[model samples]
Target chain A: MSTFMQFITTGLRLGSVYALIALGYTMVYGIIKLINFAHGDFIMVGGYTLFFTIPAFMKLGLPGWAAVFIAIIVCAVVGMLVELLAYRPVRKRGNNLTSLITAIAMSFILENLAQAIPAIGPDPRVPYMLFNNDIKIGSFSISVATLITIVVSAIIMIGLYQFTQKTKIGRAMRCVSEDKQAAVLMGINVNKVIIITFAIGAGLAAVAALMYIAQYPKVTTTMGATLGIYAFVSAVLGGIGSLPGAMLGGIIIGIVQSGTSTYISSSMADTFVYLILIVVLMVKPAGILGKNIGEKV
Target chain B: MLNIKDLCVSYGAISALKGISLTVNDGELVTLIGANGAGKTTTLHTISGLLKASSGTIMLDDIDLQKTPAHKIIEYGMAQVPEGRHVFAQMTVLENLYMGAYSISDKKKIEDNIEWVFHHFPRLKERSKQLAGTLSGGEQQMLATGRAIMTNPKIVLMDEPSMGLSPLLVSEIFSIIKELQKSGITILLVEQNAKMALSIADRAYVLENGKISMSGNASELLNDERVKKAYLGA
Candidate 1:
């Protein structure tokens, strides 16, 4: 029972990080109808940003929480720049193929940038529990860092929900996604909305990075590599473009990974995750919450 | 309030609006009526900047709009309530209304505009929280109109607002158009139902095969033999 509890605890933590990154992929895809391959590098950038800023933040007598907030904002601003210089022109031309290739190029550029920075130590292993102390209950132990991640994630998701449901900007996003020409006629600047979308998604990925490093305590040029794959998988498992669907898919995947790893060898754990994805695809190709996208040819 | 001189718009090699020229003074509800494939919708689309004019000029209060991008056109005091009532599907009715005022800089003015929209479309108020995609056709049309009005443009452009609506809803929509005109907002109206389009219009233009075939006072055009046969089905 205690062993089972460990899996549950660990699964939730990993799942939470995957879900946050997945939100980035799903959101960009939802609005632009193209996968932002550069999104993975946004995660890597977040880790490195945190790495360099932590010392300065500590020197300034800022708390761990403040440091995380600053880091996320900085990363978000960097994300906005990427949108402006890298993605916007391609998007404006309405060329999906070019946008895809541009995103991939941006991802590699970010990863290389991180490697070029000194004292980032080439492969900066993010120290575990750098901020949070742990909480133990009955023979099972859980980190306060993980708890913080869960709480912060909940707040972010809620904020996103309200933004999309109650605001003018949110409505504009929906209209543009439905029909770009119609939205332009309504005076909704499709380009500005797309830029904001990228900023928000990248910011959330930064927050996820902080929480993620808490458990793993490792950050390298490729820190986000495996998680990116997993996050993409989680997004596909959920309905692409369906916000709630991504959340559900993440949790399901976490539980599956944990449950399988606990019972079987850890080497086979990834296989279990893949198997579940296969089952989900076989059962419902659009995913658990995906709507069927139609093309009028 | 608006003038187009020799306006020509095309898609690829095919001309959609060929040297169409017309004028709509301020405080007038002008309608363009034509059959399917006739250039009615194209003229509106070009004016609203949804489609570019290949050659010609669009001037509203002296703002040259020939080279302006689509979203910026609204900033020049024009808003389009598009065809198919393209309300934001996932958004609530209230949220859709807010989108109309998106570019407005004044917070208080935006708030007042929302209240005014709610006042004008009381049905939308009742269903304010319902997702617009779930709205009935008429309600969607109402939301579309309210959304445009939120921008508080000097002029509103509507394309086939009555399309896909039942007869009763069509009447309701026309009444709303009348109400907007009474408030002194210049309107550019396009429709397939020429009789209904001409009835409320101050001036009417007939478009055929991508050009303006005739222009006259709405009541006068309604009685013309050609207009009567093609549009009124007389």
Candidate 2:
């Protein structure tokens, strides 16, 4: 039972991170109907920001966690820049293929740019530890980092829900997603809403990156690649455009991955995760939470 | 007042509006009537800055509308009820009205505008928490119009508010439009239902093939031989 509890904790921690990253994917998809293949790189960018800033801050006798704010700002700016410089021009073309291709190209550009940078290079560096202690509870132990990951993710998720439901800008985002031209007629600046969406999505990704490296403690250019694919699958499994679906999908994928690795074999973990995705697709193609909206003529 | 002078628009090589001119004086309800593909919608879209004019000018109270972006055009106190009653399906009716008041930042004003919409559209008030998609066709039309009114615009540009409705609902919406005009809102109405549009409008313009073929007082145009033959199906 304790062993199972341990695995559950691990699953929840990993699931929290995946849920955060999936939100970035889902939101960008919701508004623009683009997959934003570059979304995963925002995590890598956040990771590197932490890698560089954490030590620098500790050297100045400040808390390493304070670096998170800087990383969030950096990721947001990078996300907005990616949207403005790359996606906006293609979006103006109003061709889905062109936008998709652009998103993939942007992903490659970010990955390669990180690889080519002299400071970053191809080396995998260990991130500074934010929380190393663990809490002991009735024959089961969970790391402080794991608890923080789940709690923080839940808090952020709830905050995001409130923002989208209660705030004016949040309503505008939904409005733009529903009918962009009608949103424009309502005096909404569509471009500004999109830019803000990218910012928020990428900012959440930064938080996910912090939680991620807290557990794995690795920073590499390609680290986000696998992580991103998993989150993308999570978003798809949950329902590509639905926020709750992304969260549920991430948790399910995380549990499956942890369970497979714990009981079956580490090597079989990914296979099982992917197999579940295939099975879910077969059964519910629109995703678990996705509505099957008929295409309007 | 809205004044559009010699506006020209094109979709690449295909000119949609070929030098059309029109005006809506303050406190006047002007209707632009035409058949399908006669550029009535095009004229409204161009005026609202949705589509750029290749040449010519659109002036709303001395502001060069040609220079304003589509999103900013509403700040000049102009709102459009697009042809399809494009309510945000996932949003509640109340939320849709809040979206209409997007540009207005004052909290009290927004509340008051919402209350005003609720007053004018009591059905919308009752379904305030309901998702817009669930509303019937006539109810959706009311929500759309109520949404535009939330902007509190000096001019409301309505495109086919009666597009798809029962005859009873058609008369109901027309009566609401009449009430809005009596309450002192300037309107530029575009419609294929020429007979209904003519009956309510103070003045009218007959658009054919992207140009204003005739312009006159509404009652006179209603009696004109050409208007009756071509539009009224006399």
Candidate 3:
């Protein structure tokens, strides 16, 4: 029973990472109706940012918390750069083909760039371990850092929800998502909203990456590639445009992986995940939270 | 007051709004009627800052609306209810209405405006928590109008509000529009249903292939044989 609890707790902890990464996918898909395949590379960039941030953090004699703050900021800027350079110019109609190719190219570019650099090339590993052992709660155990990350992830989601619900910028983003022409007629700057969407999505990715390496204690050029694919799967599982769905999908996927790995072959955990996804898709193509989308007649 | 002078809007090589001139006095409800692709919507789009005027001036009171960005046009007190009742489908009715007052920063004023929207759309009040996608077509139209009114603009532009509605709902929507005008809000209505639109309009313009072919009092244009054959389907 304790072992089962441990698996569940650990699954929930990893679920937070998937949830954060999934949000980036959902938000971009909601706003622009585009799948930013390069989003995973954005996560990789964020991880590297955290890596470089440690030396500066130590030089300033800052505590561990301060280092995280610096890392998040740097990662956010890197995300914005990806948007300005890679995504902005190809936003016109009928540019989806080029954009898709561009996104794939960008994903590989970020990965290869890290591989080419001597310091980070080939393989990357965390220089220091930031997390202590699990904190126990009634025999269910979870790491302190993982617990903090899960809590922080929830707070970020809440912040995102509030912004989308309460602010003008948020309203504009929704309007654009619903109908770009109508949004334009209502005096909304669609371009600005799209840029902001990319920024926020990138920022979330950065936070997720920071937590990711803190627990795993390793980083590499090719990091976040498989994880990025899974995050996209989570977004689809939940409903690509629905925020809550993304998080819920993440938790479900995490639970399946952890649950299966515990009782079955750990090496076949990925197969179980894919099997679940296939079954879920066959049952409901729009996803658990995703409604069937249609255009106004 | 609004003045659109010598406005010409083109989509690629095809002109959607030719060199057209028109004037609307303060506190006047005007309608533009035509068949599909007759440029009724284009005129409104250009005036509302959604589309740029290739060569023209769109003046509202003392300001040149043609030069302002689409996002800032609402600051000049003009709001548009786009074609087909374009409410944010995923948002709750209350959230949809609140989006209309996005530029109005005063919290109290925004609240009062929301209350006023609820008052104008009492049905919306009962369904405020409901997702806009779930509403009936008529209700969505009402919500769209209510959302536009929340801006408290001097003028509201609507494109085809009566489309895709039952006759009863059509009458219902038109009466509410009339009540809005009676309460002293200028309206720019673009429609394919010329007869219904002209009945409530103070003045009317007939757009033909991107140019104003006829302009006069609503009653006079309603009686015009050309309008009768082309738009009224008489």
Candidate 4:
């Protein structure tokens, strides 16, 4: 039972990070119908930002939380900058194929550019040990990092729910997602709403990065590229456009990975995640909570 | 007051509106009546800044609407009840109403407009929590009108308010249109139901093939021999 508990706790920690990243993918897709392939790279950007800032801040006698704050701010600005400079032109042209190609290109550019930069070279840098303690309940032991990740993600999710449901700007996001023309007719600045969406998604990626590094501690230029794929899969699993769906999908995928690694082979864990994705695609193409909207006549 | 002069719109090789001009004066309910493809809806769209005019001037009071973007047109006191009743299908009726007041920042004013909308369409109030997609055809039309009204505009552009409704619902909708005019709102109505539209309009224009074929008092057009033969189904 204690072993089972350990697996559950570990799975949840991984799932929380996945959920945060998946949300960025789902939100951009929901509003613009663009998959935003570069969303994952935003995490790498956040990690690198933290790597440089945390050490520098520590030397300047600032606490580590200040580094996290700066990293998040930097990532949010990068996300919005990507939207403004890279994505907006293609979106305005009304070319989905071009927008998608641009996203993929942006992803490559972000990853390769980080490697090419002298300061943030290809080598992996271990993050500052922010939470190193462990919490023992009964015979099972879990790291404080895991506990913080779960709690922080939950708070973020709750905050997101309130913003989307109760706020005017959040409502505009929903309106734009449903019908762009209708939203414009209702006097909504669709472009502004989209920019805000990108900013929020990127900020979430940064937070996810912080929590993610808490568990793994290693940061690499290519880390976001691999983790992005898993998060994208999670978004698809949960219904790409649905907020709650992204969270649920992340948790399920986490559990599956943990189970496979524990019972089967750790080497085959990723294979199982993909296999489940294939089955889901064949059975329910819309994902778990996604509504299959009929094309308006 | 609103005015359009020589508005021309084209979608690629096909021209939807060719040199169409019309005007709606303050506190008057004006209707543009025509058959399908007669440029009635196109005229409203051009005025609302949804479709760009090839070469024309749209003046809404002191503002030049021709240069305005679609999202900003409503701020100049123009709201459209679109032809097909384009309510946000996924949103609840109450949420849809809130979206209608998207430009307004005052929370109290938004609430007041919502209450006013509910007063106008009590059925909307009954189904306030319901998803707009699930509403009946007439109910959706009512919701569309209510949503537009919630914007608190000076001039309301209604495109096909009576489209796809039962006879009973049609009369109910027409009555509401009359009630809306009495409430001090200027209106620019576009309709394929020329008979009903002409009867309520303070002034009317007959559009054919993207041009103003005739213009006069609504009651005069209702009795004219040409209108009686072509539109009144006499």
* Whole-model lDDT values for every prediction: 0.83, 0.92, 0.83, 0.90
Per-residue lDDT tens digits for candidate 4, residues B1-234, read 998888899888889888988889999999999888898888888888878889989999889998788899998888889988989999999999999999888999999999999999999999999999888889999999999988788999999988888789988999999899899899999988988998899999999998899999999999999989998899
Interface RMS deviation of candidate 4: 1.8
Question: What ranking emerges by lDDT with the best candidate at the front?
Answer: 2, 4, 3, 1
Query: What TM-score would chain B of candidate 1 score versus the native chain B?
Result: 0.98
DockQ of each: 0.47, 0.69, 0.53, 0.69
For all the models shown, what interface RMSD does each have? Answer: 4.0, 2.1, 2.0, 1.8
What candidate 3 gets wrong by more than 4 Å, as runs, is A136-141, A293-297
Q: Which candidate should be chosen as best, given TM-score against the real structure?
A: 2
Docking class of 4: medium
In model 4, which regions exceed 4 Å deviation?
A: A294-297
Q: Which consecutive 10 residues in model 3 chain A have the weakest lDDT in total?
A: A63-72
DockQ score of the complex predicted as candidate 2: 0.69
Please give the range of 10 consecutive residues that has the lowest summed lDDT in model 1 chain A: A120-129
Q: What is candidate 3's DockQ?
A: 0.53
TM-score of each prediction: 0.90, 0.98, 0.93, 0.97
Q: Alpha-carbon error at B151 in model 3, in Å?
A: 1.8
What TM-scores result for chain A when each predicted structure is judged separately against the true chain A? 0.92, 0.97, 0.94, 0.97
Question: Mind giving the per-residue lDDT tens digits that candidate 2 earns over A105-127?
Answer: 99999999999998985889899
Q: Write the per-residue lDDT of candidate 4 for residues A1-297, one digit (tens) a residue.
A: 886887898899888899999999999999999999999999999999988888889899988757878888899899999999999987877699999999999999999999999889689999887788998877778899889999999899889978998999999999999888889989999999999999999999999999988778899998998889889999999999999989988988888899888888999999999999889878889998888966332
Docking class of 1: acceptable
Which model scores highest in lDDT? 2
